[model samples]
Target: MAGSLVKRQGFGTAPVFLTSICTILGAILFLRFGFAVGNLGLWQTFMIILLGHLVTIPTALAVAEIATNQKVQGGGVYFIISRSFGITIGGAIGIGLYLSQAVSTAFYIIAFAESFSPIFNYLLASDFNILVYNYRVISIPATIVLILLAIYKGADLGIKTLYLVAFVLFFSLLFFFLGTTEYAQNMESIPWDAKILNGKSFFYFFAVCFPAFTGMAAGAGLSGDLKNPSKSIPRGTIWATIAGMIIYMVTALKLAISAPPGDLAADQFIMQDIALWGPAIPIGLAAASLSSAIGSILVAPRTLQAIGADKILPNSFVNDWVSQVRLKSNEPVNASIITSVITLIFVIIGDIDIVAQIITMFFMVTYGAICSISFLEHFTADPAYRPIFRSKWYVSLVGALACIFLMFQISVFYSIMALIIMAIIYQTTSYYKEDKEGLANIFQGVIFQLSRRLKVFLQKADPDSKEDHWRPSVVCISSNTFERFSAFNMLRWISHKYGFGNYIHLIEGYLSRETYKEAKECVNRMVKLSDSTKSRVYMDTIVSPSITSAIAQVIQLPGVSGKDNNMIMFEFSKKKPEGLENIVDNFKLVKSTDFDICVLGSSEKNFGFKQNIDIWITSKDYENASLMILMGFIILGHPEWKNARIRLMVLSPEKELEKQRNKIRELIRTGRLPISLNNVELNEHKDNIEAKSIINEKSKDADLVIIGVRTEAIKHDSIGIFNGYEGVGDVLFVNTNKEKEIK
Candidate 1:
């Protein structure tokens, strides 16, 4: 359910709307103010921009084509690249894409801050610095705090917040265009001068417009998660593109026509001057800028994840829970926070001008690689892809060419800086690739091959193990405290991480208020434990007698289920062995070797508050295979003590045995527990050996030794569990995976 909920969340209409509007406003305004010495008027704007749009259109088309095949993953461009080429290529693209987005967020934040100062400085007493403007949008501390909260809380909450903010920005942009156009008495003429096209001015104009159009594919990536991706994505992309184009066209026209040439060329973000129309106009643009920045933050991380999955980059960078961390109801909260924090870095930057330079660098360079990939889709007979929405080869060719040409238009120095960073990243990534390949090859050939020659390598965690049919019977013991919290933590300590071992929890019986209070504390302590455990079970306390009486009574009463073969574990904190003697005495006569009891250490609530768990479990042998049983408990402590280990062992009668140990080694790979395993299987069956002799030989220096006991059927026998556990000796005998007797 958590998984399903995590998949559906996407950037809602508000983000899309604002992003589109911002696109229109930003494109138009920037194009007009950039004042590329292009003598071209309105009509020539089309041809100059046509080449730029060519560079951008392929990005969207390729994104859509890739999205169609692998839409649900939401890995974005990285996903497309990884699936077609390979994970190594994907990972590289992923890191590059994500870092690009991170850089892009910072750029937008600076842009938002820069756009606001001229309007704010005029009206407020606060003297905003124009010299070092972009970096100081909101206080950096405030922004960082916001970021931490978003991530600490997770993705669902963060995305919703961003979507709402973006919505407000959409209206702001709409109002900026509507507000400005409402007043302009004369429309600027469409000039068709060939002079503007001849020089570097056209290229520079294309360069400036490049970064503005990159965010539209963000919405298209949602196709996989959408209700109907094939239909919805195509429609959304087309609409979003058209929407972005309109905003760009209108804003540019307004800026060029209305502003005196001197004022138009005064600043890059001259769109902010629309406040001259009315006070409210400034508010809209400010809101729009904020939204644009947020929209970018929301879309970028998934791109990295998708790419990471394909192996083009380091898979380690991919976050498993990102798309799934539902915020309030369920939103992409993790991505939002990460994006926002990065955005804030740029926002508070002092130099507003650097904002444009960084933004230019992100789009110009990243897009070049993307366009190159797109070019491959057309030029080469690569079977890797088939376009869902094929642009004519000429269109694809022009887009790729245009993207390449725009790269040159950007300042050579900055372009060099971007390329150098990319090259270093590429080299570092290539080395890592070689190392990973080496490891894979070693594992495939050398390690296993050499293991046969090394005695030490052949030695298993357990030297002597019985034929494990893997039918280790499961016994689930639960009490009122079992699922309450305390036993939960204890179970966690008992279970191994990455999912290993068989486990059982003593669900103590029910009690009156006073005992309930005591039991809850015990349960809380158990739940708070940091030990590695796989599964936790609850025994019905009220089904029979209370926990204290049930331990005594269950032994005397006929056994119901798994009382014969499996050992039962009981946890209590009596310092002296006297209080537990009665518990042991009751079961002593049931064939002494039939079962065993274990006493656990008492838990201390030192700080009153601890990591997610409330219990602490310590086995004499911290490394135990029995820890695998604590899976549920281990998961319980996942909020904290995520890597808590469960050292465990299962003592058998025989001292030496061998069986399927390889499967056991691979069981707990999720990064929690490192298993330490050992086994002692007695050669002779109990009938042939003296009970004393068996006990001495089986548990010479064992931390815990559990055995099975005979069971009887009683009226309350339906409720089966680890009976006579509370008063056992140092060794603990637990039940099997089943509720049957170990006998």
Candidate 2:
């Protein structure tokens, strides 16, 4: 169905230019510019024209840039958007765009009905009792005729009709500019700032005028019928946009000079009185309105057909119906019927004030999305995105921003409603459709570029600014990853906030092709595991020959947070401490880098509910006390530990217990730590008592026990210091390289 338009010889640039220009100078120019000039004055009206072009001009440039970069298929704007941003997000916006285009058919048809007002007034005066009181007499027939033409004759008839209307529109404007009124000849000087009293506000008029510029993309809707969309689209769209802006500026000026502000404000058809041939104004209005309606009728069905072809709708049956095309003529018959139904329903409603605002919001969102794609492509600097016609990044940025700003500026309620509708559509499509290509696929490249730039900036910053406060930049190495999750769990808690963590899975083997492939699988497994837990730790794999060699390689790895690693963590089971010797042997090498160390001794309980944490501090462990407390605080920052509490247990001689208790209290207060005084306990220990027995007896109920590790003990081969902790669920032995202040 989408390729139906490509079967023919295809149109040249003429239809593209005619379709857009006709819509650009349609009902708005004939019906509303006089009102704008009267309310906002000539200078302010000029500003409105410029402001509208601010959005349209950039959008034109963006469309040109994007069309040149890729093959634009049946959907036109929808095709360009879905291909760049992925189908799900693009489908969400495409639905809105299609509805707006469909409803616009009715909007223009109703305006065309307004052109019958002069005849209706004459009928009412002569006592001709027909349906002259109701404008639907004209609207309903006009709508049926147009729908029949679309269903039978298709785009071929629509393009031919556009050419005739475009000619009438141009002649009407010329006659209005040529005529000279008494007000213009008698005026001493032009009133550049003349406006009627109690007129509408600037934004109100802006909302009324902005849609005129939106027709610049009217040509893009014919992309499927173009011989070469990459060349014809840019040329037709840009030329129409500039021509429309210049014509509008001149039209505003002519209206200001020809008519008084009072008459212009009172009569929407004041151009009739100003023109040399008075009847030409109403004739032009009727022609422009019909042309725009025909343009919309031609474009809306193709958009719906393209969407159905992509299978974006939830129901397969509906998709099949909408995507069906006429075999010989290559026309979207079913889609045209749907578009007609939507248009007729809105036509019956007649008063579409609220609906019009919503349509405006939809157009604004589409324009913004196009500009965003162009800007992101520029930012990513992807080789695949090279376009022959390039738009400046700043121009695209301004266009995107203006669309968003003007959305709320036009109507805050409608803007929010439009966004909510798109979100709902996106989620619904995502649930029924399995599309891996999504907004994330595009953002991935954008995030990579951003991360690279930030890393370089941070690396070049002054080092002194970073040393004032300390946060953990931890690196964890493990070979028993599948065997236990304690190491990974710790990494997640630390990396949750205020820190960074990188976990490397150590495979104790030489690097081979098989090993490299296995390492990639291991990384994928780790990623799935991390995603399941919503963990923030970055995962990787290293295939080194020995645990010591892996540890040496892992320690040199930089932190993902763009900081140097300051802490290293290792894990082993308490029941089987086979990996402890290798870790102890590499302590000297880790110490040479001045990195703090944490060795986890896990048990069968697997941290046991994560409720209670016990931190044991001794008089001889002054250097490790601050780090141990900080680690506990950092772990508590994770939501998994939300209900958990920490107990700071201190051991000293009986005489010095009071001194140590006050010192701990002062540190907690100064650091603004969450620990209460009641949770801090002081204990008396004699010289004969061993530290292991005291920990086993006191911390039996603790889910986790944090105990200080001394360099002197490790150097002297005091491996007994880490043994005999069967009572506790898990134990973390913390060693600090230097004293860290609480502040």
Candidate 3:
């Protein structure tokens, strides 16, 4: 069968509203309404109802907003949650929602048997002990019958039955209201006490009463079945909540005024005693329980089907099995059977109060997650998160907080248990191997917005105020580092000085579509290399036939204005490439763009252990001294070079050498190079040959060499073959473009 044909939609607005009403106005109203009124009195009973709705209203609004934001499918709450929070959290909450619905089916079926057992009490052969034992035994068959009816008839029959049940429920309420009127008139004779009647606190009553309002999710769970879920869900949920609230409040008022406080507190079957016709009470209970069971059974299996269809859970066999549908009915028959089996287990256990508490805890977490998604979407201000059903962020925040607060208020142990189960499920689902493409959950948007703001703030902050504030903002030509990985490694090390690096890959060809694709692929490879090397480098590719023009354009690449790339670097090959001369001629052009330049010459031998760095200084190259010293400090800051020694060597005549050494000392102090004056080496040289010989002899064993490069050296192609440094370690030739002294 086709997938589309297997997922059927038939519900309209009226059926959805009636289904929710029937679900919310379940057996609790018939069996437990007097318990609340008796224990908490008229005022507190109304307060509990109001508090419950306060939490649910935001959750309903959140659901409405999310439903309208996207196309909703079978999962209902699970669908919304998974779409908003991703599969892991969605799967966890999906399981929680499924279990809640399954257990809720049993809860209502047990209520049915509890109410139905009274009819058998009048049988001559049955006694009280038989009533107690047979009530749970009867629930097993009652649960099976409801599940079977749902499976055979499908949701259409369930909706029609809910319509009749809703009618009968209102009819029974009319008689209840009529019977209470006479007793209400004699209000002065009834004792009204608002205290702990049965050793249960206000919050305990609140927990039991809260589930009465949670049936709102029944309409939402029918999202896939609805004719127009986005339109129907908001309308049905809001109307049902309002209707349920009114019914609960009016029932609370009637019960409070009609019965003596002692009878309201002590009698579990107080509604039957107060009914105009005794059978009306059991009839209402039966209708409420059966209707609620039908709604829960309808919703539970669909939730399981959604989880299975999405492949959020680990077991693929279970996922495939539960997601299967009957071709003719287009119903989740397999999923329904699974739900029925789970419900049967709970029905046999038949502990109503404990079941209610557990159900309440699960719903609280589910509702809180919904509200939290809405709150995050609004606060994160993601453009894609525009929801048609607009709501305030603070309101959603309050709703989320209220749901969490009530969870603990109900029972801290159960609340903790719910959270632990969800966390474990989330962790487990996170390991599921699935391609999560085109999925952007709300938390991603939140992190994105925060990162964007932080980036802006960082760009505005001054980076030159202190040594700690200094960070490398570097741009290197890709041609200089391709296959010459030592150059890329140096760039990585320099960029590790706490800032950003960008690599520009300029394709020296006509800018055609194929060239653009090739350049893009090259940039991707470079980015992958950056990842493998654990470096923070961004790669950009440009196709331009003229390498010089590309370099010129790259030097002016726009960025956060003041924090743009402060330096441009290139590699000097031993045998210069074809465009090396032209690139050298454009050095002044690059300087005009306000970026300093550094050309690297990698040794044939690997850069040996990074134990020593040597900086060769000349009288004419004083302008590059501070930058070279800063580079040495930055290199030493890296972990691999942390113990590396830095020595400043001046090969001037002895008379001028002390003055040059003193100047180097002042530069070290001013630039904060973290080196001692004893590391400065001054040697006498009579001519350029002697100076070159002195550098080769003293720095031959060093791991790295730093020297100044002038335009004359580049014009002669002597930049790579620095005098007396042919067999040395890695070399860096610095040319200062800025006039400011290092401070």
In candidate 1, what are the lDDT values of residues 43-87, reduced to their tens digit? Answer: 555655555566666666655554554444565555555554445
TM-score of each: 0.48, 0.95, 0.75
Summed backbone clashes in each candidate are 125, 0, 0
Q: What does candidate 2's lDDT look like per residue over 1-743, in tens digits? A: 56444375378888888888888988899899999999989999999999888899999999999999988877788888888888888888899999999999999999999988777766777767554767898899999999999999988888889888988998988888888899999888878999999999999999999988888888888887777988988999999999999999999998999888999998998999999898899899999899989989988998999899999999999999998878666678999999999999999999887898899999999999999999998988887888999999999999999999999999999999999988898899889877757577678889999999998898888755748779999999999888899999989999998789999998878999999999999999999999999999999999999988888888888789887799999998899998888888899999999899999999888778889999999988888988998999899999999899999889888888888988877877886455788999888888798777888899998999999989998888556768878877899999999977666
Cα deviation at 675, candidate 1, in Å, is: 78
Better of 2 and 3 by TM-score: 2
- What ranges in model 2 sit over 4 Å off? 1-6, 122-131, 188-190, 463-465, 668-674
Error of 3 at 482 (Å): 2.9
Model 3 lDDT on a 0 to 1 scale: 0.79
**lDDT for each residue of candidate 3 in 1-743, tens digit (9 for 90 to 100):** 64475556567788768878999999889888898888777888888988998898888788888888888877788899888877767787889889999999998888888787566766635554343456876788888788888789878788888888988888888778777545567667433454444556788788777888898878888887887887888788878888999999888877887776667778867777777776788888889988899899999999999999988768889889998888776688999989989998888887767767878889999999999988988877877776778878888999999998989888999999889988887778778835443235465777777777877886778855544344557787756547677667777777676556677777888888899889879988888988887875667787777768888778877442236678888775544444446557677778777678887767665568999999987887777877887787777867888888998877677678778877767766886555688888887877555555677788889888898776556656643435346657678888776433455
What C-alpha lDDT values do all the predictions have? 0.46, 0.89, 0.79
How do the candidates rank by TM-score, highest first? 2, 3, 1
Q: Mind sharing the TM-score for model 2?
A: 0.95
Q: How much is the lDDT of residue 639 in candidate 3?
A: 80
Q: RMSDs, each prediction?
A: 21.6, 2.4, 6.0
